[model samples]
Target: MQELHDAPLAPLTTFRLGGPATRLVTATTDAEVVEAVRAADESGTPLLVIGGGSNLVIGDRGFEGTALRIATTGFHLDGTRLELAAGENWSDAVARSVEAGLAGIECLAGIPGSAGATPIQNVGAYGQEVCDTITEVVAYDRTTGETVTLTAAECAFRYRNSTFKDQPDRYVVLRVRFALEDAGGLSAPIKYPETARALGVEAGDRVPAARARETVLRLRAGKGMVLDPADHDTWSAGSFFHNPILSDEAYAAFLARVRDRLGAGTAPPAYPAGEGRTKTSAAWLIDKAGFTKGYGTGPARISTKHTLALTNRGQATTEDLLALAREVVAGVHAAFGVTLVNEPVTVGVSI
Candidate 1:
């Protein structure tokens, strides 16, 4: 275990805009992780867990408590069953799965984060979500002070949210387990129309896992979802806003609003989110609301490659980033009557 006091946290996040923690503990093993958490809990100190820091927005004021960084490493594959420790880099794991001829996670390639954080958000992309393949999650239950395994269903996944996210402080994910498919070296059937179009295949057609992974990585890179420290566009928490899933009634009203604002011929991107729910595109909303790509004139701005991503173009403070976020949210809501919710978790701040 490595420990530091008054540690700067900006470098830990993709946004690169946070302040510092009162103390920072980097745990290299599950035992170290548990020990750090237990000590903090017993001492009645507030605790913040840091995984990949891909989907976080810390306040400028800094955290007044302990920040434990899970750095444990383990990646074991037994046939199609895979287990990843809390610290294993997610994108690398996806690449390994594709190299191993696995199909389930191919579409999720290029998503940046730790494997343990995957279950927390039920991370999804290009039509494949972690929930689709996750069989179970092993976490250290902070409430009971014991490690426990929770089945996928018990995780209560619902589009970018899960029990871990709902009860953020109650569980420290130790490992994530997934059951992938061999698929004879072919990828799972293509589900996203954009991906299918890009691959020149019809939806439901399968391509080589490597090809699928590569294509998704390319697509993500185009949208600034892939991490690249040199690119200001990539300096973001991937997509900053979650696609709003509205009830049928709300969708109808929103559709009317779109038509009224953009003319009768105009339409917003929509998809069935579940029974009586419709998921609309956050990118579309932001664009139609007149916040084009590369929007903003400050250290923090909309990504040049993607409007859905609010970025730090270097020298940005958390407040600057949040200021841009609030502007986008308010502008989109005013234009479309749909409020945009941030996809990343915020600490000591609300948007």
Candidate 2:
């Protein structure tokens, strides 16, 4: 375990924004992690658990409590079962799985975060979400002062949310176990249309696992979803907003509003989310609402390569980013009658 006082947090996140924490603890093992958490809890100090820092947005005021950075290292693979420490780099783990000829997580390549955080938000991209392959999450329950393993079903995963996210302070994820497929070294059937098109295969066709992983990484790089320090466009938390899933009645009202704003013939992109629910693209909404790519004059702006990402252009504050996000949300709501919600977790701030 390593401790620092008043540590700056911007350098830890992909966004490169945010202030400092009163105290920062970096734990390199599960035991250290638990001990750190227990200490904070026992002392009645507010605790903020951070892994990868990709999906986090800390305010300029910074955290006044203990910010525990999970940096533990553990990667145990037996046959098709894989267990990773909470702090393992997510993209690197995906690459390792692909190298091992695993077929489950190839599509999740280039997602920025730790393996532990994947379950927290049920992290998904390119038609793949972690909830599909994740078998269990071992977490230290702060409230009960005990470590528990919860099955995937018990996690209560929904679109970009889970039990851990719903009760953020209850559990500190320590390890994640996944069940991957061998598939004779071939990838899982391609589900996302864009990925399939890029690979020149029909949806449901399987390619080499490594090829699938590389292709997704390529696609992500093109859209600035992949982290690249040299590129301002990549200085983002992947997608700034979640695709809004609306009820049937809400979808009907939104479609009416879309037509009202974009002429009677205008049609919005909609996909079936679940029974009587439709998921519409937040990127499409932002673009149609007149906030194009690179849509801001301030330090914080939408990525030039992707409309979904809100980035920090070298120098930006959390307030600047939030301002841009709020503008985009209001503009989209005004134009389409649907409000966009942020994907990243915010601290000491609301949008």
Candidate 3:
């Protein structure tokens, strides 16, 4: 275990923003992780569990207590079953699985974060979510001070949310277990229309695993979803907002608002989210609301390559980013009666 006091946290995240933590501990083993969490809880100190920091937004005020950075390393693959330590870099692991001819996670190849954090948000991309392959999550339960295994069903995963996210302070993920498929080196059936079109394959067609992974990575790069430190557009938390899922009544009201504003010929993109729920494109709403790509005059702005990503163009504070986010949210709500919600987890701040 490595420990530091008053540690700067900006370098830890993909956005490269945030202040510092009063205490920062990098735990290289699951035992150390538990020990650190227990000590903080026993001392009645607030705790922040950090993974790759890719999906986190820490405030300028900094964390007042312990910030535990999980760095434990383990990757076990028994046939189609895979177990990963919380600290394993997510994108790299996806690449490895592709190399091993796995079919389940090829589309998630470019998402930046730790394997542990993947379950936290049920991280999904290119129409494939971690929830689809995750069989079990082994976490250190802070409430009971014990390690417990929760099945995928118990995780209660939804679009970009899970039990771990709902009770952020209650559990520190230690390991994640997944069940991948071996389709004789073939990828899973393509589900996203864009990906299928890019590959020149019809939806539900299977391509080579490597081709699927590379194609997804290329698509992600185009949208600034893949991490590229030199590019300001890539200095974001992938998509800034989740696609808004509204109830039937809410969707009807929103459609009325949209038609009233954009004219009878105009229509907003909508997909069935579940029974009686509709998911609408937040990117479309933001654009229609007049916040175009690369929108904003400040250091923080929408990514030039993607309308949905809010980015830090080298010199931006958390407040600056949040201001741009709030502006986009308010603009969309005023124009279409749909409120956008942020995808990244925020600390010491609310939007």
All candidates: TM-score: 0.99, 0.99, 0.99
- RMSD of each candidate relative to the true structure: 0.7, 0.8, 0.8
lDDT of 2 by residue, 1-351 (tens): 899999999888889888999999999998999999999999999998889999989899889999999998888999999999999999999999988988899999999889999999999888888998999999999989999999999999999999998999999999999999999889999999999999999999999999999999999999998888899998999898999999999999998998888899887888999999999999999999999999899999999999999999998999999999999999998888888999999988999
Question: Over 4 Å off in model 3, which ranges?
Answer: none
lDDT ranking from best candidate downward = 1, 2, 3
Report how far off residue 143 is in candidate 2 (Å): 1.3
Give the least accurate 10-residue stretch of model 1, judged by summed lDDT: 265-274
Instruction: Using lDDT as the measure, name the better of candidate 1 and candidate 3.
Output: 1
TM-score of 1: 0.99
Q: Give the TM-score of candidate 2.
A: 0.99
Q: Native-vs-model 1 lDDT?
A: 0.93
Backbone clashes in model 1, listed as residue pairs: none
Which ten residues in a row are the worst by lDDT in model 3? 261-270
